[model samples]
Target: MEGTAKSLIEQTSESILNYIITNNLTTGDKLPNEYKLAEEVNVGRSTLREAVRALVSRNILEVRQGSGTYVSENTGIVDDPLGFSFVKDTLKLTEDLFEIRYLLEPRVAALAATNATDEQIEELDKIRLEIEERIGAFSDEHIEKDIEFHKLVSEMSGNVAMSNLVSIINQSISRYYDYYTSNRIKDETIVSHREIMDAIKSRDPILAEDVMRIHIVTNRRSLSQNKKNNLKKE
Candidate 1:
């Protein structure tokens, strides 16, 4: 009987989670009343309360005096790992990190052009060609090269803060890339990188910044699309 109750509670929680996601519900969104949730999930109010209590403990929901239960402000992509059970929510957090990086990296490129040493430019060029070599043949190996190229550029900026920022952003982006870029569509990404590399190699700061901006913007759009595609498949 205990096991049966636990199973029902688990299923009920999952139903709530699925509903939140499908409806694009976000943080601070008010949850339906206990009676409503019970009706929607076809469970008793006692079971609904039990499940809601569990989620409340997990910081997924909050109950106010007369305001009713609301999805906590920390509920969605910003949800803490310990407080959230969904992997998709975790990916949303990752996407936010990437968005921040997208905003910062082009500035890093512009600074690198102003600050980089001759040897640094040479190093950047080397990685640029290496990345070009693996255009149509991208793999995990190429991903590493791709990161190396950016890391070298970040270091060339001679700004410790920018370098560290780039490092974190690169790491976050790497996770998304691993899932989104397979052999099926590697060329598109490789071509984009090549365009940026061309501007970098020419030492045109304005052009380099523009190219990098385009690349990051395109990448963010692509990643968002990939997430949607994965959801559809699921």
Candidate 2:
């Protein structure tokens, strides 16, 4: 607890984030220099520089060789919402991504059911409940959690190489998952997750595979729905 509190209090990155948020800063907005920021956050200039570097790695800010630091163009003000890289470049290519996930994840679920430990199943249950609790409230905000649940299942399947592959795919498709989950008026995902969980708990590999297949199909249907909605708007 002490460590957690101290970490929170000393989080220079978080202080910078709060400053940007409270000031309603936009992309391309020039932030104050390190000295000024250090004074404002009550941190040393070195600490402020470190935080800025971290944000730069996350694509939230940019520093030119000679020019002062500025908010990145892709940081959501002059670009896609929430700094979505996919939206800024290839939003229409997500169908290919979903196609691949559908091809891969059913097999992952089957393997997980066959190989996972009881403790791993418990972790799955805990994650599912957390997702359910957050349903209808910032549904898209927990995209990372949703990705994590699937990643955990993949890792628990006792197939390290496959787990690594799934992790890569998860990172790539995360933005789409966030956008997809947020746009839906009804979250059918919780039910789909429950079915997969039940199959895993029963240790029925075939059943788990079949349920997971259906879950991916359901996601495709949601994607289709979103496409249709977009057409209607146009």
Candidate 3:
């Protein structure tokens, strides 16, 4: 009995997904009223509600009290999809996170130089200036905009997976900055960001790649040194 009930719920979930696809529903689009949706999907109201709750947990749907259910912003990607917060060693996590960034981001920057649309390039410039405005303050906005700058560069590459992966790593990177951000890197990032923008703006893929590589290496060095200094005090 339990097995059959669970299968039904799973089948209903698939039906809901199919309905979303068939009707061209997108993020922020409201699902039909429960009675209508259940009928359309050929499921009972209780089954449809159960399926919707399951999707909500997977970050695929959201239910707003009194408003109705809608598709979530990131579709189905959870904020901590990799479970990075479980790691106890902050420094080790930082090192590994940067390793992934180092592997993927330079090539992404190279592609952005060749592939970015004019509007995306302009948006990149806007994010860079937003970072510049928040510089020296070193507040959350500054760090956030800095992350946005990198994430935008990935999107400019015109690779959806690359963009999403960068965003995933960015969640962990944001935490690392909360503790380890240093003055040197803060200044260096502003300079490096401008250099990256200029290289991409000029459509120089090789220079953009080289510049991004330097930026990543420089950040690893700064954070490693900061970690060492903190350890010495302890």
Candidate 4:
């Protein structure tokens, strides 16, 4: 009887989790009322509460007094590992990181275009302006601001998983950053950042996606050119 009850509660918890995912619930979104949720998951009220408690423990849900359960803001990503830090070959590591960024960031940008509020877009522009200023003055803080711009773009995407994942990369792995900052590259980077910001601000997802792709491709090309020039001098 004890084992059967445990299994039932586990199954109920999983069903609740699937419901949240299938519905695309984001942070702060309210879950169904307890009675409705219990009925939907084919569990009794007591078992449903137990399952909810389990999810709350995992930082996946939170209960508010006199309100309702909501998707937790934390989403459990804070302590996730920095994947590229263990990589030994900096060159290969950067190449891999670029590939991941290429695959993920354009979509992130597009989502940001669709989801970003006017206030968030304005904040993003502020970050972009700060980056341009620091870069022009050759202040190393520009590096931090550069990553800040990307992190803001990620946050605007409205996808908690992608936002947190990108934040992890920006905060931990800057292997490819600052490797190729020639005069031409800096000028082009400023232009590319502006293009990306403009696209998102206009709420044009397709444009956002295209410009972001171009931005990454331009950086890849600059890295390649620098490598070739270095090899020639060697």
Candidate 5:
């Protein structure tokens, strides 16, 4: 009987997850109330509560007393699923991250060129202006804007899976920028972004992909050189 109960709870939990996906519910989106969900899933209130509890423990849901159940704001690989915390070789990790970016982002930029709305392109231009205006100001806001620019491009790709993957990578790369590449935003970085913007503006997929590759490759080389220089100094 205990085993059967456990199985039911597990199945109910999975059903809830599927429901969220099917409804296109994103982080902070509220789930149907317990009563509604229980009715929809044909589960007892107790079983539904148990399933919700399991999801909460997994960082997939949150329940507020006065409010109701919500999808967790930080869903999907909540924290450092790669065990980067235990990594002793930061340079190697940075290299690995760059390798992944090299593999993913150029294609993303190509897709963005093909799919980005005019409004999205205009937003990118605004972000680019903000970045250029903040250059040499040593503002954290500039770093955030830079990250936002990349995020917008990923979203413009019109591929949810690619957008999500890029978001995950962007989180890790944000840390890298904060720690290792802070203050490394040069005029060339701004220029490269402008080139990418122009390519996308012209709706040239090949040019967008090429410039994006160059942009990432240039930064990777700069970061690599910075790491080597720091090692020499130490």
Candidate 6:
């Protein structure tokens, strides 16, 4: 009897998750009332409540005082599922991240060149212009814009799976950027970004891929050198 009850709870939880996914519910989307949800999932109120409690514990759901439960804004991969935080070698982790970016982003840029809509291409151009205008301002906003530009390119690739993977990698890179202390924005980087935008505008997949590769590789080298210098000073 206990095993059967547990199974029902698990199934109820899964059904709720599926309902959210099927309905295209995003972060902050309100869920149906408990009674309605229980009815829809063909589960008892107790079972449905237990399932929702579990999801809330997992950071997948949140219950507001009077507003009811809602999906979490950062639902997927809430914790370090792989124990990346336990890894002592920060340098290697950073390197691995860049290596992953090197493998994925050039291909993403190529696809974006071929598949991106006119509006998306125009958006990319706008981001590039923003970076150019902020080159000497020494504001971190440009760095953020750079990150957004890459993410936008990934989305423009029209591959949802690839875009999700790039977002994960880009998040890791952004975390690293918080620790990397550099105020100087290179002229080469600005020029390279412009070239990449031009290639995408021309719908030249090959050129776009090549330019992206050079851009990522250049940044990777800079980070590696910075790591080495920091280690020497320490």
Off by over 4 Å in 6: 1-9, 22-29, 44-50, 53-65, 71-83, 130-136, 177-180, 184-189
Which rank order by lDDT, best down to worst? Answer: 3, 5, 4, 6, 2, 1
Q: CA lDDT, every prediction?
A: 0.71, 0.75, 0.87, 0.83, 0.85, 0.82
Tell me the deviation in Å of residue 174 in model 3.
1.3
TM-score of 1: 0.56
- Model 2: per-residue Cα lDDT over 105-223, one tens digit each: 99999999999999999999999888777675755555666777788889878887666566556666664544455444236668878989999999999999998898778777777
The top-ranked prediction according to TM-score is: 3
Alpha-carbon runs more than 4 Å astray in model 3: 1-5, 176-180
The global Cα lDDT (0 to 1) of model 5 is: 0.85
Q: So what's the TM-score on candidate 4?
A: 0.64
TM-score of model 6 relative to the true fold?
Answer: 0.79
Q: Model 5 segments beyond 4 Å from truth?
A: 1-9, 21-28, 42-47, 56-59, 62-65, 72-77, 81-83, 133-137, 176-184
Query: Comparing 2 and 3 by TM-score, which wins?
Result: 3
lDDT of 2 at 82: 31
Residue lDDT tens for model 4, 1-234 = 367678788899899989999999999999999999999899899999999997887788899999999999867443435655556776666666777788999999999999999999999999999988998888878878878888889999998778767766655546445554687877877998999999998899999999999988887777667678888999
How far off is model 3, as Cα RMSD?
2.2
Model 6, residue 74: C-alpha shift (Å): 6.6
Clashes of each: 0, 0, 0, 0, 0, 0
Residue 206 displacement (Å), model 3: 0.6
- lDDT per residue for candidate 5 within 130-163, as digits (tens), equals 9888775656577678778898999999988776
Error of 2 at 28 (Å): 35
Please identify model 2 stretches exceeding 4 Å from their true place. 1-89, 176-186
Best by lDDT: 3
* Higher-ranked by TM-score: 3 or 4: 3
| Model 1 Cα lDDT, one tens digit per residue, 84-176 | 234566578667767776887787777777778888877777776776676645435777777777777788777876664565466555654
TM-scores for all predictions: 0.56, 0.59, 0.91, 0.64, 0.79, 0.79
Task: Please report, as a residue range, the 10-residue window in candidate 2 with the lowest summed lDDT.
Answer: 75-84
